[model samples]
Target: MDFTLSGQQRDRCASVLARTQTAFPAGPGDHQPTASASAYTRAEWSRLADLGLLGASVPTAEGGGGLGALDTALVFESAGRGCADTGILFAAAAHLFSCGMPILDFAPPDTRKRLLPRMCSGELIAGNAMTEPESGSDVARLTVTARRVADGFLLSGTKSFVSNGPVADVFVTYATTDPQAGHLGVTAFVVERGAPGLAVGQPLDKMGLLSCPAAAVTFDDCFVPDEQVLGAPGQGGAIFQHSMRWERSCLFAVYLGVQQRLLDRCVEHVRQRRQSGKRLAEFQSVSNRVVDMKLRLESGRLLLYRACDALDRDDPDASLWVSLSKLAVSEAAVASSLDAMQLFGGRGCLREEGIEAAVRDALPTTVFSGTSEIQRQLIARSIGL
Candidate 1:
């Protein structure tokens, strides 16, 4: 019930936010032409690694800060507020929550021992590969196969729309070992990069989050040694769902930070810009819209932090909270971004102003980490409706 951040958490967020603002280099020229590919330059990526952000949620024993769920959310919220590139922010979230946590919790002990330290140190980048061309939201029906081999499993299939795909050094991905067994047939693996048969496709052009490159990954009889298997052979479904709980709860915190930043920008613009000797903020129409944005943000923050607490406590309604939190924050981001753009007028439409870019990044929130429709369905089921 007490969602106020601890003093230590506040300090951590401040430190992270200050550093994030200065990390990204300015665009090539004063007049930025268009959204570039969401590629992570080595320098920016290294700077992130140096900040210890890559390992914020990992345990200190594994070279991380060992922050709890609330602390981790706070840190990411800070990053979202100042980071110039949504792709980088998105990749960081995917790396920390979607890819890293699953491996830390479910991978074989030897695999964890081998990967966690490097991943935490930023020596390696990790990606979660679950979406397939044929099965976007249906995990049970994935066609990717992990066939038994002499000493391990031979993985063969394509994982599409893989965030961090172009640059990942390891993947916490899924495949089915027994198609006839339905969900019970699913198996997860820690597939390392450069495994002979594994190949990354060209980066896909996206509407937003241009700084983070996404690509398809094809596994052609890629051998995953026995030690690389995560959990049991038939438990990948549960493992994937467990990771999604973390992603849906905390990942949207990035959007929260972004929305807050946009709100501040709009407030500043309206107060200073005058119409017929009256400031825009003085107009009831503009002020009312701003208040609405604020209300959505405050309410959504409550839901998100509560969901993080629920996950920490392993509450019975943890799943429901996660779904609600994801839905609230994501929808709020898309709506708030639009308000920010409209308030800024023509400048908002310009690619160089960065307001429209936020809208583009916000658009995908409802689709990934489960759609808004899926969240509502889950909530309906929880109350026996």
Candidate 2:
């Protein structure tokens, strides 16, 4: 498994990194900003679109660059290193998940023809709505229901933690068509923003990724035409499972970039800072701590790349490998950030240096996508333990 990037992928990464560095420089005074406000930079978003970074995974036939998972991960990692802004990267991922992949995978011919072109152009923001208030990881227990109407289905219930929720133009949502049939009864639908009874709730405040606005969406007898159903009515669970496999596997690529950035800062600080007439790196303990940081970052990167390769090849162990990657990358990110703060010492605790902000940003890694405990359980199940 060669982890080396192809020349084209390397060039793309360099291009994205240059753009991100200019657009999202570190600000003053622990002054992190959420992406929801007018302060959120759509100019950067538009720049990414213009660079064709937004649709790297979509096929060329669908107006994209036709890159694969590895290429997409390279672009995401570059973005992460350049900007700690979670909102922009997560929004891009959400678009690929809800719009790009699904349209390519399951959309009827006319639906795909209508939606894919605009999505590739970045004119349409898309979201995936799966988590209900009561049913998050336990997707089988979701209570959102869709009863059949004359032309389509009447969708009713609420979905929470929807990424790109507040401003998304389309939602790839799920609901139960038969209440008693469990997961098999689930169905997927594409709900347009202005559908008769669809409403975007107020954005939820979060600990980290403040820039990525997340909110609840309510469907009050929302009318979804038959044409909007993603696949066959009973196939929603399969579609969702497939989506999660990709999400859990690849979502951490950008976070891995963040880990690399944090590691670099630690290395720079230790090389220059002094303690008791010796540089920080001269102290064995300090040097060992930095070594640990480097170790974690490298290991996490390997796991992520391994997962990406497995996904690219459609390997049988893809799901298991992805679970391992997600677990390793998320935990390593938090650990590396904490180490960065410690290495920075007094300056790290202060908000002005941006170390504290990195710590705050890293806090969410353990909870989102899937929790550490959940990942362990999945790993256990994979090995038949």
Candidate 3:
């Protein structure tokens, strides 16, 4: 399969990269001392929205660009190379995965008409509320409950580790309407911010991705109108599953750009730095490490491109390919980041230099959107092994 990007896609990627470099330069103060540090740059977010890059993957019918997953991934990869703020990319990926695709695929007409336009215009921010305190990877075991009410449904539950929870204008939340039905009992609802009895909890301190705010959300008899329900009752599991597949597959394209940056830095460093009267690249050990980094970087890109192709084709094996791509890209990114840090020696550890920050930021790739172990299990199931 020819993985070369089309000429138009290449131009789009170049444009985004140029804009991001000029508008969002990495700074010494970019490193956060606290885990709960607000990492999003409102101006940058607005700029991306204005460019219509925020809605690149949404359908054109909804006022979006209607770009495919591959195009979106390329844009994200470019952004990652240019910006140190991971929060912006995370927010975009979350919005596309949770709100853009699912709503386009399954939402009722009125709901779509009301939400998609604002989302396309970048006037609204959306999040996914899935992980409960008791249930992280186990979607079937979620304890949050929603009971049928006269007008809509009374939702009462707590969702933990919610991305963009504090600032989200809307949330795609999952709850159980009938615990006895297990996965079949779950349903999805669009919960607007500031709705009655809804509260955003304190933001959690995380080890990495400091810019992407994560918090717990509590719904205490919060009423969601029947019209707000996504898909239908008992379809939450399927929706969640599909959303996660997309998230895991395409979200790391941004990191691909980061890997490219690291590779360039490594190349420059080895060429310019001398060790024991010889350039760093002359040393067999240094050359081998650089080669390893290149291998990981190239292979990761291939996996992502393959996954994107599968998605575009609407292939039946798309889910398996996506899981594999997620596993490959995330783990490879972590390895590449670590290798880059090691190649830089003590300079990489210095906070102001940004290598340490890259390492820290890459740490979360393996844990979110379903952990690495979960990906392995899914892949295993696909092969019936």
Alpha-carbon lDDT, every model = 0.86, 0.80, 0.83
Q: Give candidate 2 regions above 4 Å deviation.
A: 28-31, 34-41
lDDT of each residue in 79-197, candidate 2, tens digit only: 88887665567677767754568767888888887888787787787888988899888777778899999989999999987987887888999999987888989999988898999
Q: Candidate 1 lDDT, tens digit per residue, 1-385?
A: 4656778888888998888877754352112224554377767777777766788878998778797777778888888887756668788889988888998898888889889988887788888899999998789999899999988999999999888899999998999999999989999998889898999999888887777778999999999999999999999999999999989987888888988888888899999999889999999999999998999998888989988888888898999989999999999999998998899898898777788888888999999999999899999998898
The residue pairs in collision within model 2 are 35-211
Candidates arranged by lDDT, highest first? 1, 3, 2
- What TM-scores do the predictions have? 0.96, 0.94, 0.95
Query: Where is the poorest 10-residue window by lDDT in model 1?
Result: 25-34
lDDT of 1: 0.86
The runs of at least 3 residues in candidate 3 whose Cα sits more than 4 Å from the true structure, single-residue gaps closed, are 28-37
TM-score of 1: 0.96
Model 3, 1-385: lDDT tens digits are 5767789988888888888877677667334334535657566567767656668788788878788887778888888877777666777788877667787777888998899878877788788899998998889988889999887899998998788776788889999998999899999889889799899987777777767777899999999998888899889999888888678877888888878888888999999989899999999988998998889888888888888888889989888888888898889889988988888898888877677778888888998888999999999999998
Clash number for each model: 4, 1, 1
